[model samples]
Target: MTRALIADANLIKKVQAGEDPIGCVLCNQACLVEDVSNPIISCQLNPDAGYELEPTPKGFFQTRLKPTRLIKNSIVSIVGSGPAGMELAVSLAEAGFEVELFEKDRELGGALRRISNAGVGGVWCRSLTHYLARIENGRIKTFTDNEVLPDDIAQMAERGPLFLATGSVGSSCHSTMSGYHNWISSSDLLKSPLPAHQERVYVLDNKGDHESAWAVETAACFSDEVVLVTADPSPFSRLHKTGDLMPAISRARSLGVKFLTFTEMRAKGDSVEISKRFSPQRELVQDHMVIEVGARESSRLIEVDGNQTRQIFEIGDCFAPRTIQDAIREARCYSRALLELVAT
Candidate 1:
């Protein structure tokens, strides 16, 4: 299936010929975000990949009109450098809005910077080279390591709309638990390598997303024993949308990883409390716990000093925790509308 995602007729020809071979970087963000029921597979990085025309109410096909670049001297301020903020900045710039982006981190790419360690060969992240180059050339003004606050938003949005793509923070739900010590955020996995030689590990999988799978899989490699704890009926249940679902599940089981399904963890006392849905609570101990059910929104409404066409928007994970595909698609959709708003 991974190989199937690599093939496209004309794309294959170009790849072989060493032309613009990266027509599809397989970022896996764009093509699959569409609802399975009403599927329209398109590339997140390249708008032309599968998005050119649309059907009208009269059942007639019409070319999707490009945003008309306005001559206004307006500037849009965007917070965060994650997928959503980066894409939105580029889209607004293309539509003739001057963009100023801010990121607290020294570099761009947000969570993807950490994800570079993964096996995807950096091809996908490199797809942003066009816009990243633009930053170097000063087409878009970027301020890395400069954190923007509500007051900053108030001031920036005075010129135009302000968008908060500030991404997310670790979930605080399980933090109040008594035995919540020695746990690492799921984000830790993306950021760095785990220490060697742990005796046992507990992987928390409440959200059942890719991070959960990664946590369990990583723990299995180093720890003597691994246990997956989830409140859902199954482990990595949300992974049915991706190709890694079955392989991850089967591999976990084969690697001596135990499943504690229909169970929830709150306290990490002498023995960790495992609250079961249908029965009495249980307890177990582990050397470390990886909380993969991460990300609470970090954005909040900024009280603009004055209303000078100052619109505020929250996109990507900040709007709500979601997949990279959702983050990109969300930004793209918002960009189209934002262009129209400023054009008028």
Candidate 2:
């Protein structure tokens, strides 16, 4: 059955290149959000996701027509080599600008790397691999294992433009949980080592996104029993798309993980106490707890913006916490606008 599904030439090619052609374990935000606003079965990663026509749609085939470069030989220092920073750096480089991207981590890709390592990112890892390959051959100079401080930004701004895309940090758990000793952040669990041999795991789903779903799945892997408590009515509530949501739900069910919707959870010693929201109910207990709340913009570099240069700008999660596609699109638009400004 799996062999039959891998019969497509394109899928074969992708697999041969060590890429995931089918699994897209994204949050399905673009698909659902687009459906609400308009009615397109679009994908955040692929521009031509669901469009199938004779000659294909005009927008599907349309490519970015490179404008005449006016910003020549300008050196742009970009902080944080995440999706937003990489997209902006590549755009600026293509526009005949020298780009130097610095990442605090040893490698690029930011959160995607950690998410991929958690084995839940699906095709997101392929996107990161592609981006890394592009950066390797592109004119953009990358500096891994380098943290860009505010002073560094000021110094860079003295030469030319300085862009920040420092991504986001995990949001602190604000739940009225009594115990903090055994609690772990979602990002920390994804990046660091997982807890071994948990008897009972409780995942607090604050985001109601794929991350929460993935957290449940991850916990289920190491724990004998798992419980996901969320204020939302359903797991992956934001993921209304058929392609993304069903598989995620199926995966969770297969792992024997229980879902407690419209519930609030608090820590109580060795056990996590969960209660039904707006109901007279009994509080259930679990041995371990993981908080899968969303993150806030991490931008200490932008806090002390002593740079007087008009070119100093912040993009990506540093500007606001959003999806990877949102960050890339914003960076691309801003890069084009900057080019237009220089041209004018």
lDDT of 2 by residue, 17-82 (tens): 996453343434444444566675544443333333323222311222222242355577888877
Residue ranges of candidate 2 with Cα displaced over 4 Å: 1-33, 36-71, 173-182, 188-199, 221-224, 266-273, 284-287, 295-297, 302-310
Top-scoring candidate (lDDT): 2
Checking candidate 2 for backbone clashes, the offending pairs are: none
lDDT of 1: 0.64
Which candidate's TM-score is highest? 2
Clash tally for model 1: 1
RMSD values for the candidates in order, in angstroms, are 6.9, 7.9
